[model samples]
Target: MCVDSPLPHLDRPFDYQVPAEAAAAAQPGTRVKVRFSGQLIDGFVLERAAGSDHEGKLSFLDKVVSPEPVLTPRVARLAREVADRYAGTLSDVLRLAIPPRHARAEAAPPAEPPPPFTAAVDGLAWHRYVAGAALLRALADGRAPRAVWTALPGEDWPARLAAAAATSLAAGRGALIVVADARDLDRLDAALLRVLGGPGHHVALSAAAGPSERYKRFLAVARGSARIVIGTRAAAFAPVADLGLVAIWDDGDDLHSDQRAPYPHARQVLLARAELEHCAAIVGGFGRTAEAQQLIETGWAIEVGATREELRRSMPRVVTVGEQERARDNAQAAAARLPTLAWRAARDALNAGAPVLIQVPRRGYLPAVACADCFTPARCAVCSGPLALPAAHGVPSCRWCGRPAADHACPQCGRRRLRAAVVGARRTAEELARAFPDTPVRTSGRDGILTSVPGEATLVVSTPGAEPLADGGFGAVLLLDAWAFLTRADLRGTEEALRRWFAAAALARPGAPVVVVADGGLVAVQALLRFDPAWLAARELAERRELGFPPAVRIAALTGPPAAVAELLSLAELPPGAEVLGPVPAAEEGHERMLVRTTRSAGKALALALKTAAGARSVRKAADPVKIQVDPLDLL
Candidate 1:
């Protein structure tokens, strides 16, 4: 049985004698109670054995916790594989795969079977792709092909994916789809319900659902009552029977990465599942990441994207407004918060009876503050933390330590007055309110995000993803404070900025104008104008390959107290050609981090080496704990 204990030394399964009362219930996949180290713990029955391998007498199972199988045999094996891939314990992966059992949920009636799949319900969006129809055909035939699809903005990708799932179901196979967040989940769920003509055949698993509902849906999949499962990151491990397809939407999103131990990314997990289960895989998104591109280059997945002519015909018209263009008009207008080009676009859009979308990089009021006289950034007097204005017409306070800086003096200018250096969504809304007093100004962000805006001549100021969709689409879009995004210290800064720009621009009606307030010479800006995310993604992958970065290689991050971390590293038997970075200081006091890089082909060897070291440390009862994260996204 796979025990509940997470101890690395005891990661393997153990043989257990089933008592007379529990033998009938202790089937493979069922939960049972077993004694380990003088304590009773819950575990899943992996398999039935004829005899024990250990020479010592095996202890009898205390009792059977549940007669129902919580995990399918395929899922149990897949969990073990995922654990090895992430250099994590089997118990940890099981914790992620299996939710806490609820007796009430188990007693619920099985979900109704879905209506027979009909080809008439095929998604219309597939017609726009170059090979979308063929891919759907392959899925229906259970061909187990893999593809990396770049979905067009404003396209009904959920419908397309749901149609694919329908095709799989028609073939008497199951499908599992994972998306980025609740919003995506809701959209996909609605689309699936429509495509399937009902909801009883599929389970919508979401963390936002209460424990009872979540467990009920999970059991539906585990019990083979649902042929399709849709959810967020955690859904990647759903125990769908006879899995024929696995799809992940918006793979670039951070939410797709699990935050718990092992920290397996959704895309990678789904890819692994496709291999293990011999199923088809689809990694579809509006923007492509370097990892996805690598899959195409490595011949592991095929590429599916729109042709250049189709892209130009479907995408919005994009224009870049640089400082030089803004300065040619008037010096005073150039120094204004809104550039001359943006001002004209907003004015024109408003005049044309269409809403204008203004995307700011940050949220809140006066997110960044500086001295009025010398323009030096304001900081707290006590702790020297960066100061910000949380509310309009309010005193500035430390963003880090919460100390007020009402009477603060700049070190450079010794000025008491503070000025706004970086404007936020709320501040932008206030300014737009004053600029066009008669027009309605709606703000969208963390405070109260609007899902959709009414079709009207208004200003919708939002922060990135929080931008509300305009009915019939907006007439114009303005991407403000572009430098804030393009100049980030992240390796994917340009790629991410272009993604945000494309997302906001896509909200505009076809042929509508999109003005980006940044230098036009940037390759990212060019990619945005051409509506070619694939080009930018290819460029990013090329650069990473040249630099020996991720997708082209594997990286492992180890973090802990310096001495403990060093000891762990010393004990690790790194793969051949593995290179060590540094024991750099971490954000936490007395803690340090280090990175190890190896070729992609050697990733498994490196993971095994690290797992061996961790297991050895656990057996020795090491005092210090070191966190090992493979293929880490956030190096900083």
Candidate 2:
């Protein structure tokens, strides 16, 4: 027998009895097994009730999978809110929020002790770091806290994480540090290992760490064996004891999403964790996301950074190169296609015995392939691979599943011999090498090419992973494909382009010529030309406001099977002023997605309606799966 709460109509929690053998170690947060409909199912223990509503009839817990109670009161409470925010379910949120159990890997030996990190954090480092302290305090207080948002220049950002780790360890507390990429984590881990060396102080938590390593680290955090934790998006729910701070670096990056079931984003999990744990949070990035700016405006966070001039001294000089002008002037076209001035500046800098850095907007050999004539996507019939003319192989290979096949004629247009429509790091590298043939052209992107190019006579082609230049400086930097960015249709396309531009520019030597390819007339271009992220953010912020998007309102998306999504949309009981945008058709699977937008005042209610609908018994009985994404970056 299973204990169903009387409020079965609502998506709320119900308690189940613990089996006699498991009761000894059974805790509120532990995972438990229960018999429901004559089948064993997994369930979490919200609490251990003294008695039940049943007249002395109670189903004992089947078993306690682990002694560790993964869910905290903070996590449970926040899970409910998250479910509501994205029109998701507590079960779904839980599934996304908590990492899976690894019995085999859980028993592995702990990693070797890290080297001592005792460098004095002073001056530039100290100032940049102190701002993150607010987050450190919230975590120590033991409340799931809201995520934080802060904007800083690239030059001043590296040491900020070190300061966070120092602050946490200094307080005799533990923490988990997560970044958007492997390189960022490596930098943070190295910096932390140098600043606070101890086996239990800090650990890099990534899927690449292997199951045993991850499990050992996970168990350590759950057991409160480590105080400081560091990893990627998946590490958001890391069970650090006395969880004090949850800091998200560059929340704007798409890499923050889990890309798996429950499909949670780091920012969401951090905020949920903060709210549940009452921990202070800090979301810091070189550029501000409207979402973060919204948090600041709502009095949830404080803004911290240097004055424009102070930042400019540390910031690189940016200039825009017009493609139209280049096309008009054959003289300019002779230099390069990505951006002539930027490319030449990089070459000249390299010739002067300094490394040059380049940033491409999108990744892969062409993530999106379209009909050359009609501009409609040319997908492979066998596997939906975007057809491309590979410089290495004539046959195009599906980027996703890697099925190689001949380019089929565009069924719609009967056009064959598709051309490379999009520019990527590989293409960029090939072009740069041809331009600076004599100079060594090192590249990094999806190829695992590290960005640590020697800062002498080298042209480094990278797609964002190239950071803090291996030597702490690059003589010149190129912000290529500026128009390639302006042409993108995504909401954050411009914002992300600017962020990448700023990040790449930050690698340049002060006063070095940084060239952007977009026309200087464009807003994003002018913003870079002016070296003003604040101004750009303000403009983006205003646009978001006028559009009734997040910062002004909360938005949630439901995508998956069309019928299921439509069903969820139909059942939505939105509060007044909380409007439903669409059961609109999505790009794939004829999938339908319903977007719920709510004003600030009605945000919680809208969230609640979604929660109710998702957890409703009627909807659950329908037995359909719809992916719920809150603050979704990919609307298509």
Candidate 3:
């Protein structure tokens, strides 16, 4: 049954007396339909105990939903902790651990075999590698390593992790690697497959993969066949037996967290699994997020760093764009283009027969725009819509509601013309194409364009998620528009922006011009210039510590329906000095959301409130269907 049920806490299991016919099917871990409080609820069979607390008649199990019992003893404990820590329901965590029953089958054949590589194991020294051989030794024993966390930096991170996958099988243990994006997983898998010649060495698992592909990979893990599994966030709970390693690449990426029930992060899940199952964890990234640094600081992990000389040799040329101002027609354009220095750098790289990489913040044509007169974004009259520039034809439209002919005269003014409020990848690509009419400009961005044609004077423009040019290397990386990411009012905005810059810079060849366009005095830029991620992490952590943010403190954001959310807050048992900050209305219309802020002890306090508050008659909240996010990546 769902762990939130009052049965287990009541010190007795309900004697939903099963008949002899269905007795064999009603095994532990088997899901069943049971009548609880006049409602049919889905539950897992914990055990068949021979007792009851009440004198009333007992209910029989509706039937065993599935014969497969996915809830392992180890997973059960971890799921419980995950629920308690996040102030969520056990079923929520379980949902993430186990996929849909229909996805449990193998539907596709194996992929073509990859060629094997012959590397002398003994000749390879540990110092040159980011991953430790000791981790290899531990995974060999079917036991996980207990290192806290030591993040890896550099563009070769994926290749190094692929090498890690190679070590797993030789050690007689399987591997499960989780990354932020499908691109990352594909990169790691391709690198590993280059090392593993066989067809069954690895498989990709993601929603993007067809049902057949996902099913095949899932079956391989569950059946203890596939030794190495690579996927996006969902691969965290891959049922690989004797799991030697669970490497999570770029743990700081928001894509690693599940948006559904339990809201568990792959990094958090890996940490818990490593502790519970005694597996080694390798969380690597171009930038050292505070969460990873915390593991090293707490002595839970050992520090691994590149040599100072090697680091310097691999470092890119750093530049700041915010210090300079452009005097086009002696006035600043509402939509800023590339700084002259950055443009020159790109021009030089192209002149040298090398492609240039430009990183922008948003996608589509004029994603954000402002009024020329009022200097605020133009909106639709009837329904507020974000106005955008016309791309295909001469007609502009509302980007929000997609109202055709959004060329409406502003209600505030009689003027029909609206200025382009924002500069998107599309608009910038078009503008840059116009400026460099002689050069071949192509977009390798989120609009679904993967790569561009290779040419000396090629301008490869892109958005954040669709950063390309990593296959080989870029001659110059133009980190444009510092204000876009820095101005975001989120907790990890700067951290994320820095990470993106570092990753894009890493894609550039050593000593290549990595022109950064940001305020010179900005701490993130300074930190990158110094190539000191730890310094940045520690400083950022200090700010969070003073503000009672995560790492120094744990804050849980509980969100749900309005009346139900409010009722839960009122009935919650908060501790002394702990505070309930908000039942204050959320910006989301019709949603009665609340913020219950407190110390780390708030985990328990919030749990108590949810369990009791869900019992209210008026709300009928259905077991506190609140979304609890711990150490949330996006604080919006």
Top candidate on lDDT is 1
Poorest 10 consecutive residues by lDDT, candidate 3? 3-12
Model 3 lDDT per residue over 272-367, tens place:
777877777877777878888778777776655666675777677877767365435422131237676777778788788777888887788777
Candidate 1 vs 2: which has more lDDT: 1
State candidate 3's TM-score. 0.87
Q: Candidate 1 lDDT, tens digit per residue, 209-319?
A: 978899988988887779899999888999998999999987888888899988989899899999999999999988888888889988999998888787777788888
Q: How many residue pairs clash in all the candidates, one count each?
A: 0, 28, 16
- Segments in model 1 whose C-alpha atoms lie over 4 Å from true places: 323-336
Whole-model Cα lDDT per candidate? 0.86, 0.67, 0.68
Q: Model 2 Cα displacement at 191 (Å)? A: 0.8
**Could you tell me the TM-score of candidate 1?**
0.96
Candidate 2 local Cα displacement, residue 355, angstroms: 1.2
Stretches of candidate 3 above 4 Å error? Answer: 1-43, 47-58, 103-126, 129-154, 327-336, 404-407, 410-414, 451-457, 560-563, 601-605, 615-627
Tens digits of per-residue lDDT, candidate 2, 422-493, equal: 767777777677767787877776657583666677777787745446475788887776767788888888
